[model samples]
Target: MTDSFLTISGFRKTFGSIVAVEDVSLNIPKGEFLTFLGPSGSGKSTTLYAVAGFDDPSAGDISIDGRSILATPPHKRNIGMVFQRYTLFPHLPVGENIAFPLRVRGHSAADIAKTVKAMLSLVRLEGFEDRLPAQLSGGQQQRVALARALAYDPPVLLMDEPLSALDKKLREEIQVEIRRIHQETGVTILYVTHDQEEALRLSDRIAVFNHGRIEQVGSGEDLYARPATRFVAGFIGDSNFLKVREVERRGSAASAILPDGTRIENIPAHAGNGHAATPELMVRPQSLKFVQGSGAGLAVKVKDVTFLGDTSSVLLETGWGQEIWLRGAGSAVKTNALSGPLHVEWNPADSHLFC
Candidate 1:
């Protein structure tokens, strides 16, 4: 933790009887892009605001460069921020807005001008320096706001759903820009967003928040492949949950009987409280494969199939009425024309078990 550039220890925020953030802790390495990702009111934003010094934690501390900054005010923390809305100054032209931060820090006018130009170039908005914010598109204004935040070269930049106001195409465009900017400057970034795609696109690691706590912190692949809890399994991707009866445990793996009475062995087991409660299976759509006979795996009746360009989604139902979805490449699935019961199979390692 001492090697981490930014450390948040036991951060908690309470509003009288309500707790917004509860015992959140994180360590962000220098130059690493870390994202706080979750749904609204899941404590992701509250934790970000605490780091930005907009709100104080009821208990705990935030530190930068191995030193505590809990006593520091927002302006003195030397952290830059972009919010859900563009906070650019409407009265100032783009050039002046980018120069404001440097000017406030008492940089010489010449240095401010130089920094502003470099920032504009970094964000690829060179010719629009003199244009008013109103004259620019939503994406353009956000780029200017980002330029202003980066003008002084803050050690950490915090972004909170900065592209939520833009259209889908524009949002994706700005996401690429943000990634490029991060790579260019190597500024340690603590980005906050509710979009999983955005987090997976930009973050070196993602901290998944839920119910005022971080359930897991890992790379996108880690969370999607091996989730720590039921909430995470459901949140990260398209997962089918099947209620299974726990048969036995062998070391870290467990044997469970599926709803269709097929026994699956060697599935990873993680019963959080050191005991299995009720066994459940979590499998991604793409993990299941179609097979020729019922002896290979569980049997399900094909209900529907939907084509989605590269992949097709196959909906299946167990005799007990449990629904399962599988994804196969378009060429692999000719089942849209073939009708009957089909067997679905998956490697035991491809599925996760939780209690």
Candidate 2:
């Protein structure tokens, strides 16, 4: 892409028999907040370590601005890193913690002071410079760690589940702070996390990993709206699945018949060549709507409805034990209008037919 500045190509790592990363390739644009999002043991952290020079790749290369940096050591890589735990020195003051990187890089005392001051402001920890990291809140400590990383003015930054230690509200506040800082400084960032909402909220693009290989790499909308595989469809979020009893590949648009004899027309399924024939249909609960229609969609009985404030979820089932989920406003399902045999219609664009 035109925005690409840091390109990681064909990077792989193995621990004896187990592979941590396999042919991981992605272009991280300069000034973009890119996130490696996946579950635990999925190699997101390992990949971050590889890029930061903590873990060398068994194969492939990591390059910045089209030049390979695979041989560069962590301290010399000009990449700042903030770990999940605040790895700060106990004896050093918060200001000293931020200035240590600069001091080691041969910056004079005056330069270090100036740099540390600016860095402290960047993380909004200017006033607490004299205090120790242990004296601060979890959020404050994390901010100090961030300030320390950015103190040396590294061109690239790496973060590994940095806010996992904080509470949800604080984590969210720090997330927004991180996003704003990235925007203001235009530093290239490679953030690692397992939270889908965090990835969707803070990333320029998210690389989803599974079994050490990239399941799909795309914008949040791309991955969420148009997932590439069943793993992605089910993993990133919830989906109501139905077995494909019959397949009718009609040109670009294909239709699959569910076990309930309900025919759902899908918006052109891309050929899944290597996958086994585990026939299924995946659709977001929001796709299915309880509307007034006949001989269209599926006939389902509302088994339960859950209120989630913004959107209400309705769980339904077919006579033959197939399940369906519908999403709407919380107040919409109070009436008994949708409890009985109701028509559950989903747009062809919303459903994906997999065979």
For each candidate in the order shown, give its overall lDDT on alpha carbons: 0.89, 0.84
Largest TM-score belongs to which candidate?
A: 1
Q: Write the per-residue lDDT of candidate 2 for residues 117-160, one digit (tens) a residue.
A: 89888998778889987898989988898888888778899999
TM-score of 2: 0.95
Off by over 4 Å in 1: 272-277
* TM-score of each model, in listed order: 0.96, 0.95
Query: Which residue pairs clash within candidate 2?
Result: none
Query: Cα deviation in Å at residue 62, candidate 1?
Result: 0.5
lDDT of 1 by residue, 155-188 (tens): 9999999999999999999999999999999999
Worst 10 residues of 2 by lDDT: 265-274
Q: Residue 314 of candidate 2: its Cα lDDT? A: 83
Model 2 residue 62 CA deviation in Å: 0.8
Q: Pick the candidate with the highest lDDT.
A: 1
Which ten contiguous residues of candidate 1 have the minimum total lDDT?
270-279
